[model samples]
Target chain A: MCAAASSPPAANPDRKSNAGATPDPWEACARLEYGGDRSPAWSVREELLATPPEGWPAAETRLLKSLARADATAAGRAFLCQMLALVGSAQSVPALAALLKDVDAVESARYALEAIPGAEASAALREGIAAVSGSAKAGMIGSIAIRGDTSARYLLAGIKGNPSEPAIVREAAGRALEHLATAKA
Target chain B: MPTASTVTRRRFLQQSGVATAVAAAPLILPSGLRGAGAPSRKITVGIVGAGNISDSHFGPLLGDPENVRILAVCDVDRERRDDAAARVNRTYGNQDCKAYGDFRELNRRSDIDTVFVCTPDHWHALVAIDAMRNGKDVYVEKPLTLTIQEGRALVATARKYHRVAQHGTQHRSMKRFHDVAEFVRNQGLGRLDRIECFIPPNNRHVGATWKPEPVPAGLDWDMWLGPAPWRPYTSLGCHYNFRFISDSAYGQVTNWGAHYLDIGQWALDMDASGPVEVEGRGEFPSSGLFTNATKVDFTVRYANGVPMFCRTRFEGGGTVRFVGERGWLDIARNRMSASHNDLLREMQAPGKKIQLPLSNNHHENFFACVRSRQRPIADVELGHRTTTVCNLGQIAMVLGRKLRWDPAKEEFVGDAMANRLRGRAMRSPWALI
Candidate 1:
């Protein structure tokens, strides 16, 4: 069976797929770099390079929706995250925020939300701190600091002194609060 | 309005004198117990950020006989994650390897004992800190952190958790660099007074407008920009090229700087600390997605009166040239030379004083230390100090002034503006602390 088409592109199938046909060169490039072997055909990278690096709103939403599909492979979701970093905006925040609690999607979701510039993106990340813990919580705090969102100062101050929180979290909160205080300065 | 508000805040900080103290607090390591159930018989491994650099590590790591297992791979790019995991399974002739789109999943596993942090500079802090907090040793690529504060937090976390962390200034493990650093330190070049370090501008060239592009399949663009400020992606703005943009990295200053500058620190006997003052000026692209300097020139001074001038130009294909009372010595990636032709012969005789730590391979050193629990050559503190040099140079470049750094405090000397730039504020879901 042709594995590439067996699961519709929109379906975003699981990592384990029917094995006969080769994935599209774009997907292949991602695979080649991620695995032990790099240097797939130059043609694969060029296929991506060929796409003009502008005006991606439509594709961004479509890919975000694709995450819910049962067929979504780890590679496919990761790929979507990468693209979102380039094209994502406040509109992409809700989808990314929802994944803030998902262990597998949290980092990429945070990555997308972090790079997006808007109050809504900041809100989602601020909200994310409550939903996640450990690394994910630390990551959300890091993103809030990166955004320079001073509105979270009170929230961050609370975390800095919150004894029940992990030491890493408190440390991150202190660092972010300093940034907000200094950035506002 | 921004200027007014900023001035008011600055005055408040300056009047109270409290913020500086908070920023300059000692890097105390808090108590953190190791995670339970870490594999004892074999070191379980995972990979994060499977980019081109991943190739350099995977071969050496995956091939370690009987003691190493590549159990999982994670990356924002799905294709890379799945493919990398599949490849690992293929190498071991099994289908047990797991693919994760989020590094947190890799961080959550008590079974995996180590993680290869091959991500971009910006993601290093969160990923490394999280893994250490969860009880995994890390081999993180350099400039260890994108900002000085991030480096401090990571170092504290490593110490607090008692994890063996290796920063990816691989030159520490190479014999060529080790040989020269030892010779310079041992007075082979006589009383060292000055050293000149150099690297290429590495800005390359590209157009400016950072408009959004069509999000590609099999790539998570958002995850790629983790913890960095939001900007619409241009083709050149993402991928390995993120270095050019000041938002994600400090260009070749940190890129090439992390490797060669590290060697300088080792030679100058300043690995445990850093320069006391830094002043620099360089050419920045007037308009583009990249904001780091193109033609770099920076000068740093140690407390010992040894001055190191760093530049981005070529003189004899050299990475650094150490000048001493006897003569001068030059060393680069491919070759090394000295004022006296016989200096090489004398140094190679093997009874040389001050023999530096030796590790012929970076990957081997890291895994060896994992078992022994000894600090690798490029340990977290060493990595932090070296990266601090680059950050200082870049900070001075941006501030357009000579800034005195209190290396003991790891903060600028009363310069709130420069101090503030030490690290950036994160947006959400991420903080460097």
Candidate 2:
């Protein structure tokens, strides 16, 4: 039974050093699995992160994994994306950018992208555009149009002949092209 | 514009005062009953399972001050128990109401006269039996029990206790539902040949890939699992999403199907009996999460040449379309449309014979039965029969084969393995006894 899975022992000073070194957040998340009246395990993690220990980066990455593992809401995912970006580890970039293509996390991913360094972030945005279809594509194009990026307009122009393209996508593409031409003028 | 009759002019003013006084009496007086200075009587009602559907019942039960007073609310979830208690206090202006995280504690309360078994399907039989044993009348929610054995045990317990048990099929009390059921049975729509019951698709996902989250505060996860084998806390199993799983619920078959199938049984006058032959086909997701069928079309044939068909997402939720030799009747909540208006008019005629009991109030009907010690219009047996039809449909879909059912014996005829599936082994400390 999933509920019967044994919870890890309470935090002991001796165990703290080993727990701090573990990179996966899911290991800590597994300890918090009982449902019903038990208080959330994330609250404890938040308290730990409030004043991070000496080995902060590994703990932060582990905490991000725990948040992602416990992703029940958009807000939680957004919080995880933000935390990963704050840690600024190159290893966290793929996990944060992965949120760019997740329908639930797209908007938060855009915010996290602003904090991401250079071409990797741009490449992630392009990949996110390619990954989305239907109404989601239009939303992506609208965001790109708002940023007023010429590269986004160029990519949006190439996404033709796909029937799945939403009306909003076509509208946003036209608006992006107009914004680009006007910027040139 | 106006010449008043001579007799009316003086008499009207005198009559108006008495009428005003009579109308005001119920409002102004602490107790509403007229003439006698008898103290107001309060019916003690206890609620089990303070989950989402509890609010649906609470609105009506607490709203009707004339008939009911919520005495106690119980839930495994401490948070929900407190929330329901607060709502009850706010609704009735009483602060002394009790709350219990264990239903057994609520059942043991001598103050509670009637028990509302609103818990998950698995807990229904145990709590209801305990309440009955404690000499409390019961108002159980639909799809009466989780399994056939549990249904049988519940009915047996009700009989042993000689308690009034009312299934939560509120439509039985509605005027329109009565008219539709009477129309089909009385041959107003001619000889009923086929009936179709529809339930909408459930898109909620389940399983390992659907990760478990941190358990919310003020919840008792261990108690929530109750008799079911323990599983890690997932929102999917706790709230409205519980319907998507097999462990806690029977999926849509018992949830939405219970509502529609009750109407079908009522229309067919098969409250005591059900279809003998059951068969069906369905589509399940190939992978990732959901286990219950996405779409299913099932048929059950009664001995008297009537066949009832159930389709998931064929149209929408809780819909019943009765096709007769002449015309068909389609009815859902608050909407009853027919192929022929004349048939509907005939059903509405004065002195028309309908088997439905005259009780406009669902809660009141249960309360009345509690006092009078009579069977409600929808009794335990009727609920079991209707739920059996639903269970049969699910069995057919799961087995992908035809079934022969004996409603008299309440067993699948000639299939030992299928017969065994009718009941489940309860986890320890949650015995049906």
lDDT of 2 by residue, B212-323 (tens): 6777887788777765644567775677666666567767788888888888898887888898888766554432334466676678888887888888774545688888
TM-score versus the correct structure, for each prediction: 0.67, 0.63
- Candidate 2, residue B325: CA error in Å? 1.3
* Residue range A129-181, candidate 1, lDDT tens digits: 88888656777887787678999999999998989998878888887887677
lDDT, candidate 1, B1-433, per-residue tens: 0111344422422322222212212222322333222224566888898888788878877776465788889988888888888888888999988998889888898778889999888999889998987888899998899999899988988887778788999988777787888888888877888888888766777334355577678777777777775545567777888899887889889988888888889988787799988877655553345667777777788887777877888444338888889888788878887888888787677777576766655765566566545566778998999999999989876655566899898989856556656765453445654
Docking class of 2: incorrect
Worst 10 residues of 1 chain B by lDDT: B15-24
User: Which candidate wins on TM-score?
Assistant: 1
**Fraction of true contacts reproduced, model 2?**
0.02
Which docking band does candidate 1 fall into? incorrect
